[model samples]
Structure formats: structure tokens, C-alpha cells
Target: MKQETHTVKKEFIALMAILMSLVALTIDAMLPALSQIGTSLQVADSNDSQLIITSVFLGMAMGLIFYGPLSDAYGRKKIIYLGIGIFILGNLLSIFSNSFPVMLAGRVLQGFGVASCRVVSLAMIRDQFAGPQMGKVMSLIMMFFIMVPALAPSVGQGILLFSHWRAIFVLVLVFGLICFFWLHFRQAETLVPEKRIPLSLASLKAGAAETLKHPVSRSYMLASGITFGAFLGYLSSAQQILQHQYQLGELFSLYFGALALAIGLSSFANSRLVMHFDMAKLCHWALIVITVTALAFYCYVEVLAEQPSLTALMAYLAVTFFSVGILFGNLNTLALHPLGHIAGIATSVISSVQTFISVLIGGIIGQLYDASVVPLVLGFFFCSLSTLILIYRTRKTSAI
Candidate 1:
């Protein structure tokens, strides 16, 4: 029975990962098709094209604010069903959108749909597990997400090759429906019935006030924000940088696939590394790796040529991607360590704050795109330093 229970939890977490993975795939998959969409919609200002990517994350920030508490009041299973239904609605809307503005609205709603799964997945893991083990589970879940980015661009391109870009939305709808079915039939409620809290106006006010006062929670929250913001920076611009700047459109898949695999492998390493080293130590080292790589890219872009080659871009950026695996897991575990009593509210608040800031920061920075690789490197460079400073501050406070 113990073994059977373990298997059930693993399978449950796996299902959640599948749902969360859609966010990354949906965002990146549209990259190769961005030009086609713009031309078809007759969108002016090609740079504004990234609105398709950033708007969803913006919606996710709003969704994260509610999903966790709803899951806490109800159960993970029910909230997830609502998220899927909404996600399907978004996909349908997106498939039919003929203009950039309409498409942007559809993407925003899609982000909202997935936010529940993203936050609730983390909460459910924290709901059932704790300590280093929780970090390990989160890492494993992220490993699957890393893999999604690897194939997602290629998969989207393959869909484009066979049909209109609208086909991508149809595919997303199919995937969402399948997940909804899987959850409806097989998954049990991870949150205990009695433990669920009523989400009220009073409860929201109290949860926010309480979370703000929690230093450990706030530290973890900042840690998650800085690193994830750095990641969002990459996600927003990497494909454009690789495909358009470097002119490697079709070949973008092989390079993206490699970098993504590096992230997954690094997460596996982090799960093992965290078992032996502390979270702070692991994260600091991970940043160091990324810093060195970012610096190298900056150097190459600044000095090398009229345009730095795609080879240089991938070589350095892949190293930067490796840090995401470590930072994503450790920061959350460390942040939530002291907020066990309010995991649902705290998780929701932290996730919303993290996504909200990351999107704003990443979206603003990504807008600085040029005909060169300078913007990508500079964003990574500055964001890495900001992350280091925040972690340093958090460490000093923790010691006090």
C-alpha cells in the first residue's frame, strides 16, 4: 500500500507537470510562427510581435493571485478542472483571432487558464511533501518542463508546415481536453477536506498582510523573482535572437533542443547537488556558472563581429539555461519553509508576485531588441547581477 501510494503521488505530480508544461510550449511554439502570424494579421511594427508572448505571462500573474486560494478552499482537483476549461476556451478564442489585438486578448486568457495549474502544482507538492524532499520533487517536475521547450518549437514548426498557425491552438485544445479527462478520472484530492480554507475578502486581506510580514517567505519570493525574471528574459527573446538576428530559423530547433536538455540535465544535477549542499550554496554556484556564460556572450557580442554567430549565442545561452533548474526549485523551497501554515495563500501570493514582476521586468527588457545580440546579453548580464545582490541581501538577513 505504501508503494502504491507513492506511485499515485508520482503519477499525480506528473499529470500536473503536463498541464504546467503547456505554458512553456505554447509560448515558445509560437515563436517560429510569429512572422507568419504578423504577416497574416498585417501587424505593423514587427518588434511589437512579442506581445503575443508577454501578454500570457501578464494574465498568469493575475491568475496566480486567485488559483492557490481557490485550491485551498476547494481542492486541487476541482480548481484544475476550472483552469483547463478556461484554457480550452482561450485556445478556441486564439484559433479564431484574426487581428493582433484579438490574439493578444486570447493569449492573456490562456495565461490565466494555466496559472491555476502552475501555482496549484507547487502548492500540491508542498501540501504533500516538505524539506529537501520537496525541493527534489519540484526539481523533477521542472525537468519535465525543460524538456517541453526542447521539442515545443520544433513541434510548433511541424504543425505550421502541415497546416495554418491556427492549428497550434487546435493542438493545445486537444492537449488541454486530454489532461482534463486524466484529472477527472484518476486523480484524488491532494488537499484534505477539513484543511481547505474559505476564500473570503477578509481572508485575502489577512493572507496578504501576514505574508508581507514573513521575512523568510519574502526572501524566497525575491529569490524566485530575480531568477525567474532572468529566465523570462531569455524566453521572450532567445528565439527571435537566434532565428532573426542570427538568421537560423529552421536550425533554431536543434540549438534550442540542446540548451533545453542542458537545463533538464542541470536540474537532475541540482536535485542531487541540493541533497549534499545547501540551497544558498547551490544557487550561488549556479549563478556563477550563468554569470560567466553571460559575460562571455556579452564579450563576444560587443567585440566579435558585425553580428555574433548563432554558434556563440547557443554556446553561452545554454550555460545560462543550466542555472534555471537549480534556482527554480531551491528558491521556492527556501521561501516556503517558514510559511507551512499558510502554504496555499503564501504560495499563491509568492507565485503571483514572482510572475508579475518577472513578466514586467522581462517584457520591458526584451523590448530593447535590436538587429544585434547586444540586448539579450545585456539583459542577462544586468539581471544576473540583480539576482546576486538580492540573494546576498537575503543571506545576510537570514544570518541575522
Candidate 2:
């Protein structure tokens, strides 16, 4: 019985990882298709094409606000079904879209729908685990989750060779269907009836207040927002930087995949290490490493007024992403630690607030892209510095 239970737990983790990865798959797979989508839709400004990524994040931020509360009341499985249904509908709209606005609308709907998976997965995990164990599980989940991003651009590029950009949406729709069915058959509801909160405006307000009252949660949420803002900036501009600036073109997906692989490896390393060190200590060190690396990279590019060789650039990015992999799971675990009782609404509030802030910071940084890596590096430096400050302040106030 003990061995059987351990095997079942491993299967649950794998399923949760796949569910969470669907969001990354949606974004990263679209990277290789962005240019084609822009040209097909006759976008005027090349920069506006980045909106394909940003719009989804915006929709996710909005969707999280509602999905959290709804999932808290209704239970995880039902919410996931609704979310996947919406995700498929959004993909269908995008497949049929002839205009940029219509396609963006579809992407936004996809993001909104996908937000359920993001929030509910975390809530489900929280329902089962907490503290360092939660951090370890998240790291394990992220290890597998990061694999999707590493391979997605390659998948996207492959599809583009055979079909139009709209076909990418068709692929997403199919992926959603597989996930929906797998979830329906294999996963049981994690949220229990007695624990369900009443869904109402008053409950929403009360949950928000309850979540915000915790200083540790508030501080870590802010740190996560700042750190992810830098990541978001990178995602929004990675295609342009690799293909246009470095002129990698067909090799762009390979380079992007390599960077993602770095993050995956780091997440795997973090999973092994979290059992020894606390999440807070690991997160602190990771923030410091990323901040220092970004500063060095920014100075090297800004002072020399020359682009680093591809090898040099990748080395720096590898280090930055390695630290980022550590930071993400730990920061999220730290933020959600205090609100486990209300994990659904708490995860929603934390994710929504952080995502909205990241969208603003990242969107502006992406817009500032000037065929140079300086803006990207500076964005990383500032965001990591802000995260470090928050971490310092939070630790001084209380032991998390």
C-alpha cells in the first residue's frame, strides 16, 4: 500500500506539471510564428507584433482575478474543465481570424481560459503540501514544465514549415483537448466540499483583505512581480533579438531552446538542493546572482558599444536563467505559504497582481528594444535589484 501510494503521488505530480505547462506551451510555441502572423495580418509596426505575447498575459492577469475565487468555491476539476473549454474556443477563433485584432482577441481569450490551469494547479498543490515540501514539489513540477518551453519553439518552427501560422492555433486546440480528457479521467478533485468558500462579492473582498494582511505574502508577491517582469521582457523580445539583431533566423529556435534548457537544468538542481536549504535562502542567493550577472552584462554591452559574440551572450543568459529558475519556484512557494487555507483565492490574488505588474514593466521594456541588448540587460538589472530589496525588507520584518 505504501509503495502504491508513492507511485500514485508521482503520477499526480506529472499530471500537474503537464497541466501547468500548457500555458508555457501556448506562449513559447507562438514565438516562431509571430513574424508570419504579423505579415499575414498586415501589421504596420513590426514592434506591435510583440503584442501577440503581451495580450495573452494581460488576459491571464484579468482571468486570474475571477478564476481564483470561482475555483475556491466550485472545486479544482470543474474550474479546469471550464478553462479548457474556453481555451479551445479561443484557439478556434484565432484559427479563423483574418485580422490582427481578431487574432489578439482570440489569444486573450486563450490566456484567460488558461489562467484556470495556472491558478488551480498551484491551489491543488497547496492543498496537498506546504513549506519546503511545497517548494520541492514545485521545483519538480517546474523541471518538467520547463521542458515544454525548451521544445515549443522548435515545434512551432516545424509546423510553420508544413502549414500556415493559423495551423498553430489548431495544434493548441488539439493539445487542450488531450489535456481536458486526461484530466477528466485520471485526476480526482483536490478541493473538498467543507473547505469550499461561498462565492460572492463579499467573499472576494474578504479573501483579498485576508491575503493582503500577511506581510510575507505581500512582499514576496511584489518580488515575484518584479523578477517576472524581467523574464516577460525577455519573452516579448527574444525572437526579434535572436533573428533580427543576431541574424540567426532559422537557428533562432535552437538558441531559444538552449536558453530554456538552462532554466530546466537549474530547476532540476533546485529540486535536489531545496531539501537542504530553506526556500528563502535559496531565493535570496539566486536574486543576488541574477542581479550581479545582469549588471555585468549591461556594462559590457553599454560601454563597449558592441554586441557580444553569440557564445558570450549565451553564457550570460544561461547564468541569468539558471538563477531565474531557482527564484521562480521559491518565490512562489514563499508567497503562497501564509495563505494555504485560502489557497485558491490567495493564489489568484498573488498571481493576478504580480502578472499585471509584470505585464506593465515587461511591455514597456520590450517596447524599448532598439536592436540592442542593453535595454534587456538593464531591465534585468533593475528588476532583480528591486526583488533583492523586497527580499531584504521581508526577511528583516519576519522569518519566512
Candidate 3:
């Protein structure tokens, strides 16, 4: 019985991660197109281009909050379908867009739909796994999830080589169909009737309270939010920072790939490492390593007053993201650790809040983009510092 249950659980994790990768591709593939978008739409400011990236992040972030409790109430399969449908519609609309605002509108739609895949998939996983086992599964899930996002720019660049820019959405549509059918047929229901959470205000209050009531869960949630915000900030600015600021246009895909490869490699490493270390201690140590790296990058930008090479920027940012791979999966497992019973709701709200706050902060940071690396460096530096304080205080407050 246990072995059968475990098999079912692994299948769920595999299918759900693939579902969320559609959203990943939507966001990551747009990196090479950031410059094209600004020029085609005749937008006067490069910073405004960030709205394209942030719109989806912001939309998904908000969508995630509601998706959690709702999925708990409705069951994962239905919500997953609903979310995919919405994402496909958005992708279709984006394919028709010729203006920046209209394109952003499409991105927003895509984001909302993607949230269903992301938040619901997470809720489903948390329904079955926890601790080191959870981390191991999520790490593998992330490895697949990371591939589409990491290679999106490369894919986009390649598509652009032989086709119109909007052709990317066609791919989005194709993947959406695959994911929708895969879930519709192959994936079994993970959330049982007893697990259904009603979407009442009382439910929200109760769910939020339940998650927050636990010291470990609360710290992990808040820390994950801040740590994730740093990634969002990176996502928001990476394209513009790399292409426009660094004058690395055609090479954008290669650079994006390298950065993504760093994340993928580190994630696989993290899965193995977690077996040897406690989740919190590992996350805490990863935080220290990233903070020091960000600070060093910030110092280099400030004192050097010279434009860092593409090699240098990618290297430093890669270090920051490598820590992200280490921190994200474990932190998520930590947040869901004690909430096994309410894993669905916990996954939703935790993801929603973490992403919502991160996207907002990241969008703001991206808007600070100049023709330099200072803004990106400073953003990561401050983000790391804030997350450090939040985690430390949680530890202190818990002691009290």
C-alpha cells in the first residue's frame, strides 16, 4: 500500500511540474524579445518594458493566493484545467498584440492562468510529501521546471531566427494543449473530499492563521517570500540589463542559458545535499553565502565605476541564483513541513504571498534599471539583507 501510494505521489509531482513549466516558458522566453518589444511598440522608455515581465509575475502571484484555498475546496484537477484554459487564452491574445500595453495585457492574462498550474501543482505536492523526501521530489520537479524557463530565451532566439516574434505563443499554445490533456487524462485526484477547503473568509482567516500560527512555517513562508523577491527582481531586469545595458543582443540566449544552467546544476546538488543537512540550517547557510556574494558584487560596481563584462555579471548573478535553487525548494518544504493536513491551503497562500510581494518588489527594482549593473547589484544586496533579518528575527521571536 505504501509503495503504491508513493508511486501515485511521484506521478503527480511529475505531471504537475510539467504543467507549471508552460508558465515558465512564457516568462523566460520573452527575455530576448524585451528589446524587440520596446522598439516595435515605440515605447519611449526601456524601464516600461519591464511591465511585460512583471505583469505575468504579478498576475500569477495574485492568482496563487486564491488558487490555494479554492483548489482545496474544488479539487486539484478542476482548478488545474481552469488555470490552463485561462493561460491558453492569454497566450492566444498575446500572439495578436502589436502594442506594449496590449502585450502586457496579454502577459497578465497568461500569468493568471499560469498561477493555477503553479499554485495548484504545489498544493497537490504538499498534499503528499514533507521534509527531506519533499525536498528531494521538489528538487527533481524543479529540475524539469527549470529547463523550460532556463532554455526559453534560447528557444525564443532560435524561433526568431526563422519566424516572426509572436510565433513563440504558438509554442505556448501547443504546450498548453499537451499539459491540459496530460492532466485531464493521466493525473489522478490528489486532494480527497475530506481535504476540501471551502473558500470562505472564515476559511481564509483560518487557513492564514493556521499557517502563521506555526513558528517554523511562518519563518519559512516569510523568508521564502523575500528570497524569492530577489529572483523576481533578477527576472524583471535580466533581459534589459543584459541586452540593452551590456550590448549583448544576439548572445542574450547564451547568457540566459548560462544563468539558468547555474540554477539547474545547483538545484540537483541541493537535492543531494539536503540529505546530509537540516533544511533550515542549509537554507540559513545558503543565505549567508548569497548575501556575501551580493555585497561583494555591489562593492565591485560601486568602487569599480566601470561596466562589468558580460562574463563577470553573469558569473555574479549566477552565484546569486545558485543560492536561489538551494534556498527555494527547501524553504518551501519547510513552510509546508508542519502543515501536512492543510498542505493545499498552505501551498497556495505561501506561494501567493511570497510571489505577490516578490513581484511587486522586483518590478520596482527592475524599474530602477539604468544603463548599468548597479541597480541589479544593489537590489539583490538589499533583498538578501532584508531576508536575513526576517529569518533571524523569526528565530529570535520563536525563542521568546
Candidate 4:
């Protein structure tokens, strides 16, 4: 019985992580191909290429609100199936895209489609776990999810070695199809008929109100957006910074993978430590680490008045992102802890708001790259500082 329960838990975590990875893979795997795709499509500016990344996020923000409510009303499995279908369609659109706008449109649709995977997975997790255990489970899920980013760029680069950039979409489409079948066959519907909320405007409004009205949820939700924006800034500019600026060229994936490994390790650590510490405290200290690291790096870079050595930049990023890994799971749990009854709507509103805010901030940061790490470091510092302010506000509330 014990082994059976453990096997079941492992399978559940793997599925959830893979579901989330569909989003990460779609985003990260495109990094290597951004330049190729941009040039192939005759983009006017190299910076504009980052739009390919942020556009998906924008679509996710637009689609997130609908998925949560729909999943709440319908059921988790059906919504997931629907999402995968849309994702497949998006990939096909991208595979056949002849222009930049068409590619962006396809990417947006891909994001919109996969938005179900993200929100529904979280909703299902909330259906099963709450409080610190939820945080632990999230950390465990992230442990696996982080591996996608670690390897996606390299996989993407490898694909480029033998095929056109469009082939990446074909790969993603195949992966999406496999996930769809896996969910259909292996995963049970977590939100049962009796527990499902009837889909209605009034119910959605109440759910949104309940989610935002809670002090911890509102504060952490904003904090998550701000912090994630910092991460997204790196994502958007990573190709330019690593390939063009540092001239790592073909070796860019290895460095990106190292930083991803740092984050993954921290997530694993958090999963163990959550049992011994408060989730809120973990997030607070993690933000403190990120804020301090970014601030010190910004100062160092400004004093040098040029791009810092690759080693210094890597050191700083590793520390900041490792801390970021700790914060991700904990902050999510803190935000949704009190909203389990409305997890579907709460996850939707929070995910939508955060993704929208992050995409805007990340888009600006990407545009500000300027062939130096200064903009990226500054973006990180400000975002972490902003999140620290919000986290402090949450502390003032007894609900925390």
C-alpha cells in the first residue's frame, strides 16, 4: 500500500511537471531559433525578435482567466484535452508561417492553448494539497519542470543543426500530442461533478473578488508577477546577451543550462526545507537574496562602465536565480493558500494578472538590452525591490 501510494504520487508529480513543461519548452526551445526565425522572416530589428517570446506570454495572460473558470465548471481532464488541441493547432500554424506577424499570431495561439495546462494543473494540485504541503508539492513539480529549460535550448540548437526553425514547432506539436494522450489515459479528473462550480459571470466575479480581497493572495500575486518579470527579462534577452554580446555563439545553451541547473537544485532544496520552515519566511529571504545580489551586480557593472566579464555575470545570475527558485513555489502557495475553495478562479485571475504584468515588464527589459547586462541587472534589482515591498505588506496582514 505504501509503495503504491508513493508510485501514484510520483506519477502525479511527473504529469503535473510535464504539463507545466509544455509551456517552458515552448518558450525556452524557441530561444535558439529566435535569431534564425527573425532573419528568415525579415524582421526589421533584432530586438523585435524578443516579441516572439513575449507574445506567447501575452496570449497566456489573455487566456488564463477563461481556462480556470471553464475547468471549474467542466472538469480538469476535458479542459486539458481542449488546451492540447489548441496547442497542436498553434504549432501547425507556426510550422506553416510565412511572415513575422503570422509567426507571432501562431505563438500567441500556442500560449493561449497551453494556458490550460498551467492553470488546470495548479487547480488540480490545489484540489489535492494545501498550505505548506502544497508548497512542497509545487517545489517537487518545479524540480522536474526546471529540467525542460535546462535542456530545451540545447535541444533546440541540435534541431537547428539538421533542420529549419519550423522543425522546432513540429517537435513541440509531437510532444503536445503525446502529453494529450498521457493525460487522457493516466490522469484522473480531480474536480468531480459535485465539487465543480457552475460556470457563470456572477460566480466568476465572486471568485475574483474572493481571490483579490484576501491580503496574502493579492500581495503575493503581485509579487510573483514582479519577480517573474525579472526572470522573463532574462529569458527575452538571453540569446542576444549570450550570443551577440558575449559571443558564446554555439555554446550559449551550455551556460543557459548551468543557470537553469542552479534553479532546479534550489527547488529540490526548497521541497525538503519547506517541512522545517515557514513558506512565507522562505520567500522573504529568497527575495532578499535576489534583491541584494542584483543591486550589488548593478553597482559593479556601473562602476566598470562596460559589460562585466562573463564569469561575473554568470556568478550573479546563478545566485539570483537560485533564490528565485526558492521563492516560486512558496510565493505561489502563500497566494493561493486561502483560496482553495475557488482554486480554479483564483489560479486563473492570479496567473492572468501576473503573466500580463510580467510580459509588459519583460518586453520593456528585452528592448533595453543595449548590448550590455546593465539593463537586465537593473530590471532584476527593481523587480526584486518591488516584490520585497509587497511581501512586507503581506506581513502586516494577520491573514499571512
- Pick the lDDT winner: 4
lDDT tens digits, residues 1-400, model 4?
Answer: 9999899999999999999999999999999988999999999899999999999999899889999999999999999899889888888999999999999999999999999999999999999998778888999999999999999999999999999999889889998988998888988899989999999999999999999888778889999999999899999999999988999988999999999999999999999999898777788899888889888998898889877999999999999999999988888888888899999999999999989989989989999988888889999989998898789777877444
Model 1 score (lDDT): 0.81
Tens digits of per-residue lDDT, candidate 3, 1-400, equal: 9999889777776786788788788888888877777788898987887888889987787678777777888898898888888888888888998787888888988898889888888777777776788898888888777888778899989988898778878987898889999898888788888768777889788888898778778777878887777788778888777776787888878887888888788888888987887767777778888889988987887787788777788788888888888887888887787788877678877888788778877877778777777877777778778877777766665421
RMSD of each: 1.7, 0.9, 2.3, 0.8
Better of 1 and 3 by TM-score: 1
Q: lDDT per residue, candidate 1, 288-375, as tens digits?
A: 7777778877776667667766666667776777887778888888887777777788888998998888997788777887777677
Native-referenced Cα lDDT, model 2: 0.91
Better of 1 and 2 by lDDT: 2
Q: Can you give the TM-score per candidate against the true fold?
A: 0.96, 0.98, 0.93, 0.99
lDDT of each: 0.81, 0.91, 0.81, 0.92
How do the candidates rank by lDDT, highest first? 4, 2, 3, 1
Which 10 consecutive residues of model 2 have the lowest summed lDDT? 391-400
Error of 1 at 158 (Å): 0.5
TM-score computed on alpha carbons, candidate 2:
0.98
Angstrom error at residue 398, model 1: 2.3
Clashing pairs in 4: none
